[model samples]
Target: MTEQVPVTSEMATPRRRKVFTIGAALIVLLLLLAAGTTFLWSRWTHSISNDAFVDAYLINVSPQVAGDIVEVYVREQQRVEAGQLLALIDPTPYQREVALLEAARDVATAALEKSKSELAFLEEDVPLAIAISERRLQIARDRLAEMESALLMVTRDVENGVRAASFQVEAAKAAVVLSEEDYVRYGALYEDRSATERRFEVATKSFEQARAQLEASRARLGQAEAQRQRVPITEHQRDAARGAVEEAERQVEVARLRRIEVDVKRRAVVEHRRKVTEAERAIELAATEVEYTRIVAPYDGIIARKWRHLGDYAQRGEPLFSMYDPDFVFVTCHLGEDKLDGVAPGNRVSIQLEAYGEPFEGRVLWLGSATGANFSLLPRDLSSGEFTYVIQRVPTRILVDRDERWPLLIPGLSATVRIDHGPGDPQWVEEGLRWEDRAAHLSERARD
Candidate 1:
C-alpha cells in the first residue's frame, strides 16, 4: 500500500490460488480433527488414551504352608503348569512328625490287640461264672424245699409227744384220786378193825408209779420241742448258694466294665491310626513342595519379575519369580462413555500401537463394572463444594485372536483402539465451529 504498486491479474491469480490451496488444506485438517473428536467425546466416540496398555494374566505362586525355603525350582521368569514344581521347603521337621505319628499308631494298635484279647478272656469267663451261679441257685432252691419238709415233720413229732404227755398226766390224776379214796376208806376200816393196813399201802404205791410215768413223758416232750426249734432252714446251705450267685453277678459286671474300657482303648488306637495317616499325607505334601522347588516352565512364557536370587534366604509364600503367558496377552481398553454407543460385546475392534503402525484385529470380550476414576486410590472431592462433573470411562476387554500366540506385546503397553459401532452417527467436531465465528473470536482474542 505504501508503494502503491499496480497488481497484475497473473500475480493476483497466483495469490488467490495460494490462499485457496491453504483454505482447502485447512478444511481437510478440520475434517480429520472432527473425526478424531469421537475418540474423546462423551458419546459415539472412539478416542484412545496414550496410556493404554496390553495386559495379561500372571500367576502369583505362593506356598500353602509356612517354612524356610530350601530350594527353588524355577528362576525369575520360568513358566509353570498346574502341577509343576516351583520351590521346595525344608522337610526335616515334617518328616520327623510323620515318624512320631507312625510310632504312636503302632503303640495304639498293640494296645487295641491287648484289649481284644482281654475281651475274649472275659467273654469266656463270664459265661462260665454265669452257669455256675445258675446251678448253685437251683440247688439252693431244692435244698430249701427239702429243709422245709423236714421242719414240718419235726414239728408234727413234737406235737404228738406233747399230746402223749398230756394223756399220761390225766391218767396219773385218775389213779391218784382212786388210790386216795381207797386209802381213806381202808384206813378208817382198819382203825375200826374193818380193813387191813397192807391194802392201804398198796393203793398208795400205784398212784405214785402213775405220777412218775407222767413226769417222764413230759420230759421227753420238752426235749422233742427244743430239737424242732433248733433246726435251721435249708440246713444253712442256702447262704452259700446265694453268696455264690452274688459273686458271679459281681464278676459279670466287672467283666462288662472291662469290656467298655477295652472298647475305649480300641477307639484310641483308631484315632492314632488316623493321625498317622494325616502325618503321612503331610509328608507327601511337603515332598510335593520340595519337588516344586525344581520349577520348570508349565508352558512357553517369559520372565516378568524376579523377586529372589540364588543363595538368598526366602520364607514360604515369598515371591521368587514371576512369569507371563506370552500367548494369553490381550489389551484392556477403557473406552469413554460417548464412544460406547452401539458397542456390543461381540463388536469388532482394531488396535494400534505407537511401536507398531500396523493394526491388530480383536473382539470386545468384556465391559468393566465401574469407571477408573471411581476406583482411584484418592478421588477428587467435589460434592462438598463445587459442581464438578467428571467424564467417566468404562473398561472394555478386547481379545486379539488374529495370532494364535500373543506377539511381543507386553503388559502396560501404550495402544490406540477403534470400534466400528456400525456406521456411527454424524461426527460433531464440525457442528459448532463456523469459519466466521472463529474469525471473530480470533480477532477478539488478538486484541486482548
Candidate 2:
C-alpha cells in the first residue's frame, strides 16, 4: 500500500534459490553428521543382526495308536488349554480287547482260586492219611511180634510134651512085660494042682490091665507128635503177620508220596497265579490303549494346522495337528562372531517385527554354543583338501517381554533386533515407559 516495490520473477527466483541452496547445504551437512554419529554410536554401544526371526517350539501333535478319527474338537488356529480334548479315535476295538482280556483274567482267577482250594485240602488231608498209614504199620508190627512170641512158647511146650510122652511109653512097656511073666507062672502052677483056680484068674486079669496101660501111653505119644506139626503152622502164621507189617510199611511210603503230589499241586497253584497276573497285565495294557484313543492337548497352545478330520484314518505316530505356545515366542538372531563382544545374558534388546509398527522390548536369554555353519545339512568337508574361510554367525536367543499386544506376534515372522551391549539404565527404568508414552514423548521432542 505504501510505495510497494515491483519484484521481478527472475530477481525473486534467484533470491529464493540462494536461500534454498543454503538451507539444503545445511541439511546435507547435518544429515552427514547425524549418519556419522549414529554409525559410531551403534558400533560402540550395540550389536546388530538382520539375520533374525521370531521363533518358538512348534509341536506336531500325533496319536500314539492307530485308529479312525471319530471326532474333531478343534479347527485350525483354535486356542486350546492344557489337557483339553482335541480329537477322539474309534475306541470300540480297544474297549472290546479290554473286555476280552478282562474275561480271560476272570477265568484265570477262578482257576487260581480252585487250585488254592485244592492245595489247602491236600495240605490237611495228606498228612492225616500218612499218619493213618503209619499207625496201621505200627499195628501190624505189634501183631507180628505177638505171633512170634506165641509161636516160641508153643515150640517149647511141644518139645517138652514129646519128651515126657516117650518116657511114659517106655515105662508102660516094661510093666506089661513083667505082668505077662507073672500071669504065665501062676497059670502053670494052677494047671499042675500046685495052686487054686482063683489065683490063675487073678494073674490073667493083671496082664490085661498092663496091656491097656501100654495102648494109652502110645496114644499120648502120637498126640504129642501132632502138636509138633502145629508149631510149623504157627510159624507160617507168624511169617504171614510179618508180610502184613511189610505191606503196611509200603502203604505208609505211598501215603508220603502223596505228599509229594501235594507239592506238585502247590506248584500248579503258583503257575495259575502267574497266569492270572499275566492276564491282569494284559487287561491293563488294553485299557491303556483305550485311553490312548482320546487325544488331548499336551499344553496350552494354539493350533496352527489341522491334518486329520472326522472319519479319517489316523496312523500311529502320524501328526494330527500342529501347535505352538504364543507366550513362548522369542527372537533368534544370527549375529556375526565379531559382534559378540560385550554381549551377555540379561542384556537389553530392541526388536522390530515386520508385521508390527511399534518395537518390542526383550532381554538376552542365551548364546549358542555353535555357529550356523556347524548345523548346516551339507557341511563343508575340509578333508577334501579344499577349504574356504567364512565369517561364522552365532545364534543368540532374545526373550520378548509380554504385553497386551504380544499375542499378535507369531513364530517365523521376520524381525530386526538390536542387542544393547553397553552399560545403560536399568531394565526396569527403561521398561517403565509404555509404547504410547514413548511415542508421545517423541512427538513432543519433534515439536520442540
Best by lDDT: 2
Worst 10 contiguous positions by lDDT, candidate 2: 439-448
Q: How well is each residue in 1-448 modelled by candidate 1, as lDDT tens digits?
A: 4777788897799889999999999999999898778545623444444445687766544444455666766665455554466666565666666566667666666666666666666667666666666666666666666666666676676677667766766776776677667767777887898767787667667656756766775676676556655445434544554565566567556655665665665676576666656666765665565454444444445667767654565566666656666656678888777666677665567788767767777766666888888888998788678776666788877767546335657787788887656442222213212322543443333222
Task: Give the Å error, residue 90, model 1.
Answer: 1.6
Looking at model 1, report the run of 10 residues with the lowest lDDT sum: 424-433
TM-score of each: 0.62, 0.86
Regions more than 4 Å wrong, model 1: 1-46, 79-82, 119-131, 161-303, 310-316, 387-390, 423-448
lDDT of 1 at 160: 78
Candidate lDDT values, in order: 0.63, 0.87
Q: Return model 1's CA RMSD, one decimal.
A: 13.6
TM-score of 1: 0.62
Candidate 1 lDDT score relative to the true structure? 0.63
Candidate 2's C-alpha runs over 4 A off are 1-23, 189-206, 423-448
